[model samples]
Target: MTDEGDLIAGRYRLQTRVGQGGMGIVWRATDEQLGRVVAVKQMLLHPGSDEAVTEQAVQRATREARVAARLKHPHAITVYDVVRHGGKPCLVMEFLSSRSLAAVLAEQGWLPASNVALIARQISGALAAAHEHGIVHRDVKPGNILISRDNTAKIVDFGISRATGEATVTDAGAIVGTPAFLAPEVARGGDANFASDVFSLGATLFAALEGHSPFGEVDAAIVLLARVARGQIAPPKTTGPVTDVVLAMLRNDPAARPSMRQVHEACTAIVEGRTPELPALGRPTLVLPARRPRKRVVVAGSAGVCLLATGVVIGMSLAADPTTIPEVVSPPTSATAATTVASHGCTASYRVTDAWPGGYQAEVTVAGERGRRLVGWSVTWRLPEGHTIDDLWNGVLTRTGRHVKVSGADWNAVVPAAESVAFGFVGGVADGQPVEPKLTCRTP
Candidate 1:
């Protein structure tokens, strides 16, 4: 609705449009009061959308401004103010003169696995802050991820994000995200959760590395259904840690993935010169409308017997199956736990918090000379289905289906000998139910 030299909200002069999207149009404008160039986003108000939806959108925008204004991370775009332009809403944000992930993909083809991991971690860190404040960003795609002129990653687009459990404004919800990045649950007509945001993060990273979605389609509903019912996944050709990390995050089983903190660590590990091992997708929590009835395949040459928890039965290792995944074994769990070993008057401990949807947590703590001579150490665990690797901290690493591993700085990079170094890992689980931590670590 704005044109060249249009004065917006009586104070900002509109210039050329810097960007536009499903939610709104972003224009480069001049602040008459400050006489500086700025970016203003005029939000769309659809006729079909109701008052509740519009209110929800405004509330969400306010919440996003609250976070974006205070967030100083280089990977996040800055927000300056909120105003109503011509009876509609307008958001003023920092003008980065940046290229989007979609543009980068188009111009550069697929990026290096490490680069994708780097970007994912950056976004995840921002999301972690948002999630801690009960926010869920429903739309996370390549276009929403902006890379500044200096090439720093910036996460944009919180128009659809709402505080967790808040009623949303968009009834147009045929799944509110781009098809390639929509989470299965949201695509299946359910409320988007923090875990769902994690799923979208995984999808964005997947497209960044694979030249396509891990599921291989931009079809929204079909992709959601596939994520809910099917077990088809594979990494792209330009993969290593990238393949591992993306597959782990794009898991169909939510319980099988690491927590946001874990995902952060895994991604950071990639940057820090470490590879993460993926985990098995966890068991299904919410039954899909069309899950193929589980069949009892005979176990062949198995050293350990197949086990099932919560009355769920499994016949064989899913490692051999192409179209299906094996069920998860959830033993009686603890909400919080830490595993540590004491040696030479030094102790290294890893503690976990808020394990849910088949995810585990760890807040590694160190004491004594152990932290002084930290050598390379690795943390390994399973990533269940329905969940994706969201974040990992301390170091970047690789991720695959159900297995995840990480290496850290204090753990062998900086410490000369056996030093106790602290780190942590967290992820979104598939079950939507919180689980207890039960880690059994030993020397190999």
Candidate 2:
């Protein structure tokens, strides 16, 4: 749709059509009086057009009103006003000069660590803000994440959002979200709480880094439901710090999954270079085999750092197998706590999530090779300080003052072909030492 130099609702002068969705059309328009640009969302159907269609359209529009209006977050695209025009509802929102994360991926395969970090952090902030005031963004996907020219991530489309304990646009027991990005809870139609949002965050990051979902191809709802319902088999992301972070977000049990705050911290650590310390937040994490014997296509994890390889670029450490990664990370230094988390000597690039003295986290994702024979994999990193392991998940952990070692086993540690796993740590660090985490992947 073009501007066609048409005035919408007699107030907005349509400049150009930016996007179109299942529900309505989004046009970039100029406020004739204010002389400012705004996004006008005009529903496809009006009330007088058809009773059933109009009712459904109105329900969806009203859903946006309930969530977007109530949630005033910087990461979220702002909704100005919802008015009725031509017997239909029209929504005025802030015009955004950005492209969806999906478009970015389509244009440039997988994104870099820095871009992933920025997007994840901003998305988490949006989710946190929505949760704080009792709202949940039901559909969190690459399409929902819009990146501005300056690279700021803005979450859009609350047309499917749900508020806490409120009536929902969807019928009871109806599934929601794109299958690849759907949280297990939402997939099963059990509950859509803050934890579910965290799960979607993990899926979002996975899609960003690995360029595929754990669920693989999405054909129908029943199949996706079956995949999520099982919640055991995971994708083996190859050659990056993406697997660790995504696995943390895909916990089958909501209680087992880390909170949004913790999830943000872990992802931040990977994004900003801060060492991630996962507090035994009352959940037992799963540990996949480091290297699983698969089809005969060798995925070699070269010793040298992989800046960014175009071809498969599988970095698996499979007992010499590079597919599987260490399930648990040992804390660096012992500040007299059970889990000795260290900031010193931890060298790696990490994104800053919630920065406080000694309170830090890092998230990393890894992947296996596509069409390769990967037996096992492991990720190893040292601590800046001496920290103990309060609790461990998925893999084994070994630690000493100023040093930490994590091993991925073949028995339960092998990352199958074309799959990935996530590992994180939670503990305390010394009050003053600045934490820097370094990531190293190895095979036995």
Cα error of candidate 2 at position 242, Å:
5.4
- Candidate 1 lDDT, tens digit per residue, 1-444? 568899887888987866543345678888999888888887765445687867766765676566456555566676888887666777887776766676566445467776787787788888777777777767777667777656577777565567655565543433345545656555445567777777778877866765555454322222223453344444345547656666666666556666566677778777888766446553223222322222111110000010000000111122223244323333235534446655544455654443444564445544444334433445555544554444343343445555665543211223334324344444556676443333322222
Model 2: which ten-residue window has the lowest total lDDT? 301-310
For each candidate in turn, the TM-score is: 0.57, 0.60
lDDT of 2 by residue, 217-244 (tens): 3322234445554453344545444455
**Best by lDDT, which number?**
2
Lowest lDDT 10-mer window, candidate 1?
A: 300-309
lDDT values, one for every candidate:
0.55, 0.56
Collision count for each candidate, in order: 84, 84
